[model samples]
Target: MTKVSTVTIGALALTASALAQTSIAQAQSTEHNTAEKDYRVFEKTFGATKGKRRNHTKGFCFVGEFAPVDNAILAYSNSPIFSSTSEVNGRVSHKGGKNLSPDDKFGDRGLAFEITTPDGDYHIINVNTEDFFPASKPADFIDLVRALGEGGEAVKALAAGRPELQAYLAHHKKNRDTTLRPYEGTQFNSVNAFYLVNESGDRTAIRWSMVPSGSQGIVVETNSDFLMDNMNANLTNGTVSWDMVVTIANDNDDPNNAAIRWEGEHTRITATRLTVTSTSTEADGECDAVNFDPTVLSDGFVVTDDPILEARSQIYAHGIGVRLSEKE
Candidate 1:
């Protein structure tokens, strides 16, 4: 074909592609979007970064152990994990889609642990905040991310309409101010609720938090990966640990809305102590092969009615497949 004819054909192809893209975007329904939609939005916002989890892209894995603080937890959940110390894969990360993301940003922080128990493997991916994402449902969360990505007035407008989102952002900002080093006593919460099934076939609605032994404020800020720096240094000296404190939901508490924090005083129990003895880079660690699938619960805990909690499995699956398959 002549150069002019080839150029004309390429231009037409580009126009068709643009139209198709617009059509796809316009065809989407905001209210009824599914896990697949959430995955697509995530991929579009960030990318299929090689060898990294699509979200919580930046991480450090640590081989550790999770031991129950005491057998008092057995009253709530009669699982073997609560009865004996078990091996664990602990991962800490800055919540985002970019690998090697700087630790200086005021983003949500993630702390995940995969505990291999005698019964089965149990995974819990918690966050630094006391509450979950601003969006309650899966689709709304996708919308929140899209709006935040747009920045400027879009964030303001969305938060203005949703009080929960406003409260979440406010809490995130407050924690970001107080949180310094990752392993230096940074508190992480399992914002989603779960039901702890006891031996009597009774289930207790509960939420858990990893309260650090101690916390450090920012001593000095520089263009450095101080998050991991502090974590590694802490590990070299000795093991770092957190007390997993589970909070019971009151009779009036609403477990349906994961986004809403249960107000008023409640019963809290120190269930497990997770100790990190060693660390490795995300790509070089055993955690790279493990998906910290939060939905995978043993006989101890059953899934809650929270829509966001129900939605995590598929989103996580999509992420692991994409990141691991992408050529380095």
Candidate 2:
């Protein structure tokens, strides 16, 4: 076995502390920007046209309840939903700016769920993947989007020579590729990290995911409405459920890194069961009227210092506004 040096360990610890401080500072600065200005970067980068919505614009809505598991692992945070079951309104969507049908295989897939608590509504927006791409910092994310929008040539150049782009691609290729899995088999992750603080002020860095109970091999290509049809058929039989699990961070884990997957020794505890009991077309669903901001969290769960979390909230609000404007 290789001998580890105390100096190296100390350096690593210092680096981690610095990163945490930087993340906190960035989050504070980003939160102060006007919503419109914050969103303009996302719109220009991911939207098909200026002042429009994102690429994966179409979605199906659902009504459900999130039931706490009897043996659920208790964290420090005391979010209301954890104490009792709460009604939920949610949506599953294709990730893009264009109004593509559910069956379209062009972009990533996403899920946005809102839980109604006595204090207020709590939202969790996730994509059908274990990790997020590019970088967790808002500035890096914006740069990555710009590079992607520049097309194949720019991407090729970056892959061949750019250090930042090369590192990002190397780290994220696996998770990004896995985003194409069928919805039934997909695992939706709360990409941003958060703090679970208890009444006594003890805090734990955590992230959560809604994962399918079992693997159902890859799905074959079908019609433009295949995903919707599949969901409808499943609902006809009964409610569909997913395991809601929270992954607690290890001592050495970097809470702000969205690109890393906390695995192996990291403890994952079952928090609840998310059951989708009913479905509705987008036009008839509550999703159209609700803004699913991930930052709209509950009291016990505090937003982490991660800047990406704030960026997501701003972009989501922009997407909602754009969607509403289209209807007018």
Candidate 3:
């Protein structure tokens, strides 16, 4: 009886060991698959555009400063950008193919800005849109780009059959008010998930928006240079300010999904006040050489596990390399 019991116990232990090994192997396999998928998507998308300038090809650059609101810095991120003032370099651009002029009214608009803080430089690249397209995964984004590249025919073909593409298109609406109003009044969104680490080492997933301090200014004229002219005129008069408001994530939130806007009340703290004071049209402007990668973050802030964010860093790095090679 004792011998039979010992044999049974050994068999059970062996089975448990085998199961643990299988679990580890499966986890590793999944990780490997994800890495490969990201690599393939990066190559397929950005590789074709190598040597050409980035999609938001043309930009009007500016110089400014990000000043932290003293009372608003509690319980949120400990990043220096929110605790101290920092010099900033920024650009406002029309989104489309490279060489598209600021006057192009057909494409999306973007704000790419960098803050040089004591800890490190933090880059914030936002768009006028509230949500990102192909909002969930790297492959989804690759497909969306490919479909759009093929034009209306491809979109129509996929729109009926592909729910993923359909969902993306439904959420991806350009801000029509952007061109009609002064750029200062236009709200810019992070679009991607990011984490704000507090002093206790606790991390809170959040998305932020930059809202202009004043009411939206009406655009009297419709021209290509109108956006630029308004910005310059405002800067000459005084610094234009934006309030940084963050929406904290709840348990129901999906950090990996960029398409789903955070639902619920937002914590509207004035974390940092961004003030743009001057315009720079110089070929050697500070922002001209910078990649303005959103993944380039400072301490106390981190990008979430969203595949699109990971893939963006890789693509932007590749684009920068290609651009530099062309210059050389």
Candidate 4:
């Protein structure tokens, strides 16, 4: 009788453990599904631009220098990324898969840069908007992308019940007309939040923005390669610049949900300045050799729990894999 009881109890325990493992596997599968679906949908919607970045394929590389504002940023983090100064390998691109995307149209723009320091390299990519797409999760963003295939107006439907989406669309809609071209009044936002650990190990949640130094320039619709032309012309005259403004999040802020912008007044710090001195028309420039993966950070910089940010690292890895294979 005692032997029979022991055998039965052991069987029940094994079954329970199997059930727990199955639950964990299911959760992980869901996360992967969201990320994989995002990549597949992007391919379906935008098509493939072989040997180029899956998105933001249309861009010109440039070399520049970045330095923290007189070592003022050290109070927040001692990361080498914000140390004295670093060489910048940056790319300015239209936010789309079309390699020949024109500059005259109203679309999202991107500025991705790799900062090479003495210790290591760090990267940052920001969109030319105040906040990112108001998608709470990877799945929600994929749905928006699929909806986008239907048309721009169709995307508005997703905003109907969600005030957050509505406000986001409303903000962009108003800003679209006055939208600054790549080097103009464009203020590139980090969108996702990150935690910065100082020497003492105190963590501060923040989002950074690259704001053009001068007043917002007026929009001038020009030819397809006009923006690049303008950048070259501007460089001939003088270097372009932007202020690195970091916004500190309050305790009530949600570092996990980028879909919702942090509302109300908050502390803003001018971390540093970026100066672009030279432009490159070459397809295979310094920026191409390196993947500007934002998650790839130096010490003192830590990623947040934002699911969209996490998904980006995976999605970008898939992108680089396909591009590198094309080269081979």
Q: Which candidate has the top score in lDDT?
A: 4
Residue pairs clashing in model 3 are 103-224
**Top TM-score prediction, candidate number:** 4
Give the Cα lDDT of each candidate: 0.70, 0.64, 0.64, 0.71
Once fitted onto the true fold, the runs of candidate 3 whose alpha carbons sit more than 4 angstroms away are 1-52, 102-106, 119-128, 172-179, 214-221
Per-residue lDDT of candidate 2, residues 19-124 (tens digit):
3344344545545454446556556656654322464467788888887873445556677777778877788877755565547464567887778765545545
Compared to the true structure, candidate 1 yields what TM-score? 0.83
Worst 10 residues of 1 by lDDT: 2-11
Residue 302 of model 3 has an lDDT of: 81
Which structure is stronger by TM-score: 2 or 4? 4
Worst lDDT 10-window in candidate 3: 2-11
Candidate 4 lDDT, 205-274, residue by residue in tens: 9988898874333334477767866766666655577788988899999888887778889888888888
Residue 92 error for model 3, in Å?
Answer: 1.4
How would you order the candidates by TM-score, starting with the best?
A: 4, 1, 2, 3
Candidate 2 whole-model C-alpha lDDT, 0 to 1: 0.64
RMSD after CA superposition, every candidate:
10.9, 12.7, 14.7, 12.5
Better of 1 and 3 by lDDT: 1
Clashes in model 4: which pairs? none
lDDT of 3 at 1: 23
C-alpha lDDT (0 to 100) for residue 143 of candidate 3 = 68
